[model samples]
Target: MTKGERAGADVAERAATGRAARDRLPIDGHGVFRPPADRADPVQIVFDQEADRLPDLLALRHRRMRASPLAFYRGAAAVMAADLAGQPDSGLRTQLCGDAHLFNFGLFASPERRLVFDLNDFDETCPGPFEWDLKRLLASVALAGRANGFGRRVRAGILSGAAQRYRTAMIRFAGEGELDVWYARADVDDLVTRLAKSRRRRVTRVGDKARARTTLQAYRKLTTVIDGRRRIVADPPLVVPVADLLPTVDRIALEDRIRTMLTGYRSTLAEDRRHLFDAFRFVDMARKVVGVGSVGTRCWIILLTARDDTDPLLLQVKEAGVSVLAGPDPVPDPDGEGHRVVAGQRLMQATGDIFLGWQRVPQLDGRTRDFYVRQLRDWKGSVAIDELTPRGLRTYAELCAWTLARAHARAGDRIAIAGYLGRRGRFDTALTEFAESYADQSERDHAAFRAATKS
Candidate 1:
């Protein structure tokens, strides 16, 4: 870091901030609801993305989307991205969790084993408009409320209340200095302490569930001994051993490919992370179907045994691809998709997995792919939004909004975004209006998705 480099960095940040300020000038508070007449068919976008995915698992992805509009929304980031592009944007780039839906926020263990809440999924993460992430989140609130059988009034209330929190939090962050904003976090302990008794109980229950989701529990649930060798159990389409899912040739080459990938992954880690990762010996791996949207994508769980057989570690290696947020205004990712994901996750999360890193490796057929690796089990758990009552939903919704604001504050131009979102309800109202309209589109998309899967 030379003086010239520091000056250049500061100037670049000011330019980005200037862009964000300009974005607000063109788009009125009510201008966010522009659903273009030529908005592409959501179903077609899903199908196009399916081209890079495992063909056999497409049915599972479709089935998941067919379950409900919220489920459909969860897997429809591409659709939303397309739709959002037609809407007014702030043009302020930030590290986006491209699919920042209701379900994407979750409880995960920090390195110290403390429960912390933040945006948990990042397969489609990239630098993009701050408004894009907020729109996705706001729409999810409406869709989740709909799935819970909430009326339009209640759904409207949820969106408004959540937007208020987001606005207020951003205002609060704007007052803080640079380092203060960067160090902010959503610690579960602090959250629980602020809640009423009933709400506290609910938070504790989710926290307990998160704590129970350890690597030991994952081992018991996903593995068994076969011929005196520990191996992942064959559970078709859900948690199948690699050999059971892939062709003989692909299965035969799996070990070597994984080894090489891990080697490259190790090289990407910081010295301490690499040192810790090097201690674990690769024991086995399995292709696992995970999440509603991620079903068709290549995701693997690799087992590693520490000093003794009882000491085990599980690492998840997920394929990274072009982000849904990337389009004509695509932000650059000079380091590659894997690096983009890793960087985005670190920027957005207050604390992240110690094993977080990336690798670019070619598969057996020789197609180079980017994969980001992290501990598969970090005591992660998500609430069932379908089961939340209106009151619970309201409480959960505010927390999510607050968390999203904190993430944006840390990664984007906090002062500019905070200023754009002043102390007012106009921006909030506009976003809620957009969310209601989009919820209807999601239902239509779900119906089409159901028909396509069955056909």
Candidate 2:
């Protein structure tokens, strides 16, 4: 047979796979959501995750989650995972940003030093049904729109439009060459050029802010000169220096241990990046409380300097745990949790930080934990969800949806997934309904969590 015939046969097989998925669970069936009779309590699920977290910081994590419903949702990936497990999916597996909420998509500097918008957080990243990520993203849009004081109708439109964007983008990706699809990225400059004059300033301002949030900027804000030595400032329960954290332990010994762990982490980077890392001398380290969900986890800001205190590099080493999306009989992953996050980030992102790496290190409690490391802040910024207008929310959702589809296409069978969605609005309609329903459920869960925390 000719090459043309072989290509046609391959397309036919892939399309058939997608069509067959509808039989397992019809497209419209996705709209349905009824909490199982024996569903686990959402609060309990979150509390269970705290088992391995820092005891003192658990209060801070709870406080952050209690700030608002969206805050609770940000920290409740485990809860959503349990709820999603009780539902049906398309069976099209992909590398999922397991917590693909709207807030998780943001702008960060690429290796080429250009601002690119993509999924920013990967703490829960793992291989799973592609629809799980889609559902999470849609639900987040609905929730965020509601938070922004948009009416139900407006939220519904945004959710459906976002889902449709995902479908259309996937279909487009299905028609592209492998390399073309892999190379596609959401460059911020191109996004700004496509936006209206009225909206361009807001996005441009966001980009500018991200660019200003460099390592040097962080050094000026988070460090102070103490007796001719630059050291991380102490901000109890928020940012505590290593010396303060281990008052009884010898400061030099602790610094040596941190350097040792980072040495192991450096081995994970490319030879060129390793050379780049070697130039900086470790000056100080601090335990920092960061993000709504990541508060209790072991997160450290390692301050390194080159020439003078002004020339600094801030590396954030965050703890890595088992993904909420991991199944009972999971796919064999050779690397530990830290590597899992690093691998997933590499798979989903067009370009990543040169300093991104992973290592398993012994903790202060004498237990070893997995950790992933990257710059603390390198041109990172996210839209203010609470400040967006209805139209802005819809546009942002579309951008996020398109980015997600591209990420999924890179890892999953795009032809089959696109074939499943077809050229109809059935999946879009169903997903919107699911988002509305899930948003209500999340509110109720947040209330329950708040009551539990208070008790």
Q: Which structure among the candidates has the greatest TM-score?
A: 2
* Tens-place lDDT digits, model 1, residues 1-455: 22243335553464356445745554345433545678787888989988989888888888888888888899888888888766656766667888888889999988887899999998888767777777788888888888788999999899989888988898798778778988888889888999889889988999989999999998888888888888888888877788777788978688778988899899888898888888899888988898988888888999888887688889999888888878755665666688888988998999999999998776534587788999888789888888899888888888888888899878776666766676667878877887887787788888888887776
Q: Which candidate is the best by lDDT?
A: 2
- For all predicted structures, in order, the TM-scores are 0.93, 0.96
Which portions of model 2 show Cα errors greater than 4 Å? 1-9, 248-251, 328-332
Pairs with steric clashes in candidate 2? none
lDDT of 2 by residue, 1-455 (tens): 22244356688788788889999778998995779889999999999989989999998899889887888999999999989988888887889999999889999999999999999899999988889999999988888888889999888888888999999999999999989999999999998998899899999999999999887888889999899889999999899998897765577787887789899999999999999899999999999998887878989999998887667899999998889888545564566689999999999988899999998877655777788999999999999989999999999999999999999988888888888998999999999999999889899999999999994
Native-referenced Cα lDDT, model 2? 0.89
Candidate 1 wrongly placed segments (more than 4 Å) = 1-34, 246-249, 328-334
